[model samples]
Target: MTGHDDWVPFEITPGNTGAEATARGLTAYLQGLDDLAGLLTRKKALVFRDFGVTPEELDVVMDELLPNRLAYVHGNSPRTKVGKNVYTSTEYPQEFTISMHNEMSYAYAWPSRLLFFCQQQPGTGGATPVVDGVRWLAALDPEVREAFKDGVRYTQNLHGGMGLGKSWQDTFETQDRAEVESFLATTGSTWEWKADGGLRVHQDRQATIKHPVTGDEVWFNQADQWHPAGLGDETAKALAQIMPAEDLPQNVTFADGTPIPAEYAVQIRDRGLDSAVDVDWRTGDLMLIDNVAVGHGRRPFTGARRILVAMCD
Candidate 1:
């Protein structure tokens, strides 16, 4: 085990233990577990390297690790669904770093556990950086933390089956409006069908939340990721020029509707990264994250990289 603050995950590798033996050991460890929740509460992340675990092998492992595989409903990022409730990691450009963020923090409910499988390692520099959410919260400026105390309101303008941004059908993974409405209703989110064949949705989420087991307050929202202000000045200005902020695919403001300052947004994004430790990838590497206790992101890379992702409650 590594240091707690800038922690590297506990790892198992073929070098120390044979690949087949590791798989058998891991299976036995999980099967004997009386409290998977309690284990994750203490160690927020775990990495398996050089295990030579292929896609078929992953299925066997996932059956034990993530029994209830979750679908990516109401997910914002662009990804291809590869298997039953499994998807490729974010399809962002390879040269750009995807800033640190908890998976689906803007949504009403998020996966408690995230499993990432590195099928193909990049030629250079494609580390999955992860940060302790509690550390990220404590690293922010006092004023910035205080400013976000009231929480944040998120807005999404998903198109209806077509056009720019995500279509409502794609976002919800269903063509039925009633199903989508019912799902949102359970979350206490408000929505309206726009006359232009679009759906406008609003959700207010908190910046901090307590861990269910540990009861430690951690930075938990995706305000900076969804806010236009978090985009650099040039890009933000261009976006503002093209459309009103509210009409953007997604945007965020204070729960009371006050705009968050661009500086604050940048600070939040930067500090999270600054406090992170990178988990360098190897072919057949697998990483599991406790979503509430840590946030994960990607570093810029060259050449090919393929990572498969699956989430479970």
Candidate 2:
């Protein structure tokens, strides 16, 4: 029930149950321990104003509150920042939308949490939208769920670099065939080389993975996002011709060799969009999100806008 003039924390309606505010300073506010648990339990996100906390204080708060976790740093800082040249194809340079999926969904490892801090708000557009992955998965038909439970597959071109500006080779630090093969093996994926010298890998992972904390089977992968590789260009091109974009399910395949059912894709797309909520950014507002239950992306913006992010475990 206690509050301060400089700090105004309130919950956004609907999807989010947490509190947020733009405050004058962060050190005292962050150090107060009484409300920390409640804030975390109820409101998974907290937005605050920049209060000129020194690097030492910032590190203390981040360490105490977030523990050992990766923070997606952006812009120039004494610490770390995402390089300016990095681009993301999964979303785009334009206002196109990205599908809902956990970060690093194609990889064997994924971050447990994520934090996005907005240093500047765009003149227009570029809303950060998020969806509840668990709820979205729970609403699926039992039969459809079963089909996915059989396994979910993803096909990713190891060379395109998606939007991260760095190709898989660059990210992984080696193009050696043995190293690539070893990486794929750890991900439990199957892959092949393209005639053009690209590598395509497929991962037929379980649609539902037991949550490490809750021990509940949560839906994890979306089928339409991936495809199979290794087929000759002629055959691959032929299949591409015969199939619809969603129907081809090129990335991952079933044990029986079927693509993900189109109906399921439609369902996921509709539900994901329906469940999504957007966070409008204000300068100095920092937002933390539970990546397991929520997926997030940015809206296109014009003018000078800056945001910093750190993915937390």
Best model per lDDT:
1
Return model 1's CA RMSD, one decimal.
Answer: 2.1
Write model 1 residue lDDT over 121-157, tens digit each, in one string.
9999999999988889988999999999989999999
Best by TM-score: 1
lDDT for each of the candidates?
Answer: 0.87, 0.52
Q: How many pairs of residues in model 2 come into backbone collision?
A: 19
The Cα error of candidate 2 at residue 11, in Å, is 4.8
- lDDT, model 1, position 241: 93
> Model 2: residues >4 Å from true position, as ranges?
1-24, 34-42, 49-66, 69-91, 160-166, 171-179, 193-195, 215-217, 227-250, 300-306
Candidate 1 overall lDDT versus native? 0.87
lDDT of 2 by residue, 23-96 (tens): 32344455645765456534444544343333224444455455556432211112234433222223244344
